[model samples]
Every structure is written in C-alpha cells, then in structure tokens.
Target: MSLDTTTLLAIVAMALVTYVTRIAGLFVADRLVLTGRAKAAFDAIPPAVLVAVIAPTALTTGWVEAIAAAITAVAAFRLPLLGTVAVGVISVVLLRNVL
Candidate 1:
C-alpha cells in the first residue's frame, strides 16, 4: 500500500501543532496561579469533560449502558478514580451479559 502525500502532510501538521500547543501550555502553566473560584473551576474541568464525553454515549446506546453509567457516576463520588473506572467497566460488562 502506498502512502498518500496529502495524508502524510496532514498527519505531520497535526503532530507539529499538538507538540507546539503542549509545549506552550507547559510554559504558561509554570507561571499560572489559580485561586479560590478559579482553582475550583479548574479542578472541576476534568470531571466535567469526562461527563460531557461519556454522557452522550451512555444515554444514546441503550438502557443497560444508561444504568451502568448511573451506577458508575455514583461510584465516582464514593470511590477513587481507579475504583470508579473499575465499577464502570464491570457494571457495563455485567449488564450487557445479563440484560
């Protein structure tokens, strides 16, 4: 199979842009100090983004996935990150098999 030139160029460009953006973020992050509401907001971002991504898939897929997602959300609050992920995976697998 032959590699297309345009595809290769696009891939290279994307890699370069990602690398530059990460490096820029690192430099900016060194000088950045978040406080009070800003710190709280910043801390919330990861979970918010996680929900934003997973919510659609969980809601759209099926009842079993929806239930599993709900269970996972509850576990997320009670458990640590790894435990939460474990619950999500295990619940989904068990639900898919049982229902």
Candidate 2:
C-alpha cells in the first residue's frame, strides 16, 4: 500500500546492476588486447552465442514456430544485416497476428 525503503533500494540496485552489466563490456573492451587467438574467439563468439540463445527459445515454443524461426534465421544469416532483421521482425509479427 505504501512505498517502502527496502523495495525502493532493491529496485535502484537492480537498475544499477543492469546498467553496469550492459556498459561494462565497452569499458572492458577498451582495456583488453585483441590478439590472434582472442580475435578468433571474438569472431566466433557471435554465432556461438546466437545459437546458444536461440536454440532454447525456438525449441520451447514448439516444432512449427521453432522450425520457422530457424529457417528465418538462416535466411537472415545470408542477407544483409538490415534485411535479416526485417525478415525476422516481419515473420514474428505476421505469426503473432495471424495465429
């Protein structure tokens, strides 16, 4: 019914954590050396991270949507970055509205 100090503090702390975590990478990147192996790892990281993140979401939704998203992702992978994003957004919006 009333705003409490503990809840307010917790919310502020969470916001700070989110902001720091997101921006921390920029600071960390400036500090790090991108050597041969590090460069390779960094290059490979995007696809690896994408699969890691997408696989679970796609699988959980169901075979149909999952397969659709995968197909869209693959197609997007081949297209220009903006095109890929457009394809993905269009697919999701159509699916959500139609189904």
Candidate 3:
C-alpha cells in the first residue's frame, strides 16, 4: 500500500503540534505557582477529571457499573490514585460476574 501525501503531512503536523504543546506545558508548569483557593482547586483537578471520565460510562452502562463507580468514588477519597483505580477495576469485574 502506498502512503498518501496529504495523510502523511497531516500526521506529521499533528505530531509536531502535540510535541510543541507538551514541551510548552512543561516550561509553563515549572514557572507557575498556586496558593490558597487556587491551590485547592488545582489539587482537586485530578479527581474531578477522573470522575468526569468515569461518570458517563457508569451512567450509560447499567446499574452494575453505576454501583461499581460509586464504590470507586468512595475509594478515591481514601486511597491513592493506583489504589483507587484498582478498586474500580476489581469492583467492576466482581460486580459484572455477580450481578
């Protein structure tokens, strides 16, 4: 199969843009500081993004997934990121098998 010129150019452009943005973020992040409410809000971003990603899948799937998501949410507050993810995976697998 032959590579199309337009497709090759598009792929190269996308890769360049992605690399540039990531490098820029690293530079900007090093110089940035957060304090007070801003720090709190910044700290909350990860869990909020996690929930945002998980919520739609949980809501759309079924009661089993929704229950598992609830369990995961509880774990998120008490556990580290890896532990919370472990809980989510384990709960979903067990729930799917049992219910």
* lDDT of every predicted structure (CA atoms): 0.95, 0.82, 0.93
Residue 11 in model 3: lDDT:
100
Answer with 2 or 3, whichever has the higher lDDT.
3
How many pairs of residues collide in each model? 0, 0, 0
TM-score of each model, in listed order: 0.78, 0.59, 0.76
Ranking, lDDT, top scorer first = 1, 3, 2
Per-residue C-alpha lDDT of model 3 across residues 26-80, encoded as one tens digit per residue = 9998888989998899899987897799799899999999999899989988999
Best candidate, TM-score: 1
RMSD of each: 2.5, 4.0, 2.3
In angstroms, the error of model 2 at 8 is: 1.0
How would you encode candidate 1's per-residue C-alpha lDDT over 1-99 as one tens digit per residue?
999999999999999999999999999978889999988998999989988998999999999999999999999889999999999999999999999
Residue 76's C-alpha lDDT in candidate 3?
A: 81
Kindly report which residue stretches of model 1 are placed more than 4 angstroms away from their true locations once superposed. 1-15
**Distance from true location, Cα of 78 in model 3, Å:** 3.5
* For model 3, the run of ten residues with the poorest summed lDDT: 45-54
